[model samples]
Target chain A: MSASLPSTSPFPFPRFYNFPPFFSRQPTLQTHHSQLRKWSTLILNYCRHHRIFKLSLIDALDTELLYNKSLDKRMGIGEVREVVEFMRKEGRAEWAGEGGKGVGGNEVWIWWRNPEEWASLFYEWVDDTAQKHTVLTLYELTESEATISQEFHGMDPDLLQKALSILVKRGKAQVFGQEDQQGVKFF
Target chain B: MSRKGVGLAAFDRSRITSAQYASHGNSLRSSHSTSVATQLSVFRSLLQQFAQTHAKDIRSNPSFRAEFARMCAAIGVDPLASSSGAGGKDGGGSFWAQMLGGSVNDFYFELAVRVVEVCGASREENGGLIGVKEVKDRIMSTRMEGSSEITDDDILRAVNTLKPLGSSYSTLTVGPKIYIRSVPKELNIDQSAVLEAAQVLGYVTVSMLMINLKWPRARAKTAIDDLVSESMLWVDMQCAEWEYWSPGFMLGTGDDG
Candidate 1:
């Protein structure tokens, strides 16, 4: 089963990933906290490496991120939730649903870069290209040929909207049109 | 009595002989001390020259450095000894620091700082008791490629250099492995035994301890619990019988998965 993982340049797992005890929640308070810290770092690095912006706890269970097929050790859903909750407290993760507690949520936003960071990137790109006064549709900003080399390119539209909303709030950019087809004009 | 002369003349002659003897002994003693001082100065200069010439090798080569340290120890010269107490005459710093232009002492001092960092950072994970090899690996891993290689011996020396600071950092030997214990905590006999058993398989269950050490179940459980509370052991509940793992195992299994 371990052999079936895509061998094309896999994400380098930390040494402790093979440690069986890492899958089990430590009973000791300090050890558990340390375990959580390692898990948090691994999750962030893994998502950033794969360019994964959102994670579904259920789907991730079957993946190598949560399961080590070689060791036959897998983190249970509750354990994974606890890790996500830990990340949430650190502001590195958030539940996908609005006004929904993360306790029952299956999906989460892994904020490798928080909205403010993404907004700044968008602002910098606009400023660099002298497109400050030009109007760009949400699709054009993320999917356009000009932005193909951007880190924020091919970003999730919902996340893109959230980032643009920050710019709008700062009066750095203005947003208009329908929710599905929004046009942004940066100042 | 006639050959020796009268009493007053005999007394004067005896006094002159005694004065002559005292002068001759003072001259001999002064010459002996002068030669000894000359030999010591020659030895000091030769040692200084050797250190100056091989300073680079001393810093870059771990074995050469260790051999040099051992040679100093054999001669009753402490290379890492702080000169603070004797600095009034020779300025401040260590003996080696002055002789080698501070490179050798600085090298160990810098390495000691790194060792302290690794211990402090992993204290929460391993309860401030970390394997010497693990500490070396941690330090080497963080170093840049092509940098000087650090050995376990070097780490031991670095820890030794921490003695003057009165820090709790000390080396310990448990079950054939030397560990750097950063917290001033002591392990009981049973706890150490369980730790030794865990070294074999990277972990040990209460049943394993009970059967191997002829320990009762309660005795085994207490030792494991003590280690767990100290954060020295992490308990894995996924197995049928919970296995207590030594955090040292985290760095040992690099080939798996």
Candidate 2:
């Protein structure tokens, strides 16, 4: 007895979005399983489109992430953590503190792209730009107008380092930093 | 004459098969005809013999008890329906009471009472709602180590019989889920309708209730919260759309938990 609902959702919510139980956590095992899957997919897609890296649970609670305005329902912090944790297990998200499982961080990093994928993209860009054997400051690679069109442009430096290191291991890039400046050079 | 083997004064084959129904003038058919009473007596004697011979098996095996009970029923005997016949001054009802426990009916009554006691609550307390499957599991588990198995029909029958106790104990339907309400809690039509919508998946959230019931946020929350406050439900505050679960419907309502 699912409910019938139609709305102008920013994201493609599943048909079950109208089903009341979809909003509530299911008590029965079989139903709850599908519910978890739906929540995980929602989190992944929402994060990818919104480019959400560090998502604060408290803020999400007020946003459509936790409370669907059209539906007028509120998801408790417990369920948010649960779905996000599910994403974490799938390598789609993680606790905002980088990797610690510390209690109640109330935030997560939605990693739609794995470090390996990012590294490959970075390597491909280096080749296309014909920048082999040229040195560029880490800041230039991130904030430079020339890289603005790239998907990883303005990326988190820590994540950038992770990607760049992958290239380094492949003999395609090297990172060097003086007391004043950090630079990465492509081979 | 030695009254051996049921000690019948005579083995009257003509009496059974209703020989009386045969044309009295035609004695040829009389030998083949038998009466219903005679057939029933023969069945009764044989049943008593079986019960006496396999007392231990009948008492230890649920299927065996069910079969025996079925046989007794076919003979128009209820081993546990009443305490007025068969088993002497103790008024032990039928042979069933003497053979089994008090009676099969008593077993079901005990099951019904225990179910209500464990899950029942007033409207203020969460409206004594329970999952039908869970009740069945609990009843089965609670049976004596070796007793007849109870079926869904038995549970339903027991609950139906509870009407004399009042509306406080009754079975109900909300969509596909069957719930036993054991209290005077007033679940409104809106709530009932909302529950009906969610019964397929065994849960409902405030947002879902709001949409399904066409109620305002405040109204939806009030209804769901009312249910939560009453141990009638367990809140699954794990997702963005937090849900409520009837404890009986929950997955891991277990010992490690």
lDDT of 2 by residue, A78-177 (tens): 8788887777788877686645574468767777787788888877888899987899898888778877666666677777887898999998899998
Where in model 2 is the C-alpha error above 4 Å?
Answer: A1-19, A98-104, A178-180, B1-257
Best-fitting candidate, scored by TM-score? 1
For model 2, the docking class works out as incorrect
Cα deviation in Å at residue A98, candidate 2?
A: 6.1
Q: What's the lDDT of the predicted structure labeled candidate 2?
A: 0.65
Going through the candidates in order, state the TM-score of chain A alone for each one. 0.91, 0.80
Candidate 1 chain A least-lDDT 10 residues: A1-10
List residue ranges in candidate 1 displaced over 4 A.
A1-8, B1-41, B82-89, B255-257
For residues B1-257, could you state the per-residue lDDT of candidate 1 as single tens digits? 57757778889998999999999999999998999889878987898899999999999998899899889888777777743335533656555677888888778889999999999999989999999999998888888999999889889988988988999999988989999999999999998898889999999999998889999999999999999999999988878999889999998886432
- The candidate scoring highest on lDDT is 1
**Candidate 1 colliding pairs:** none
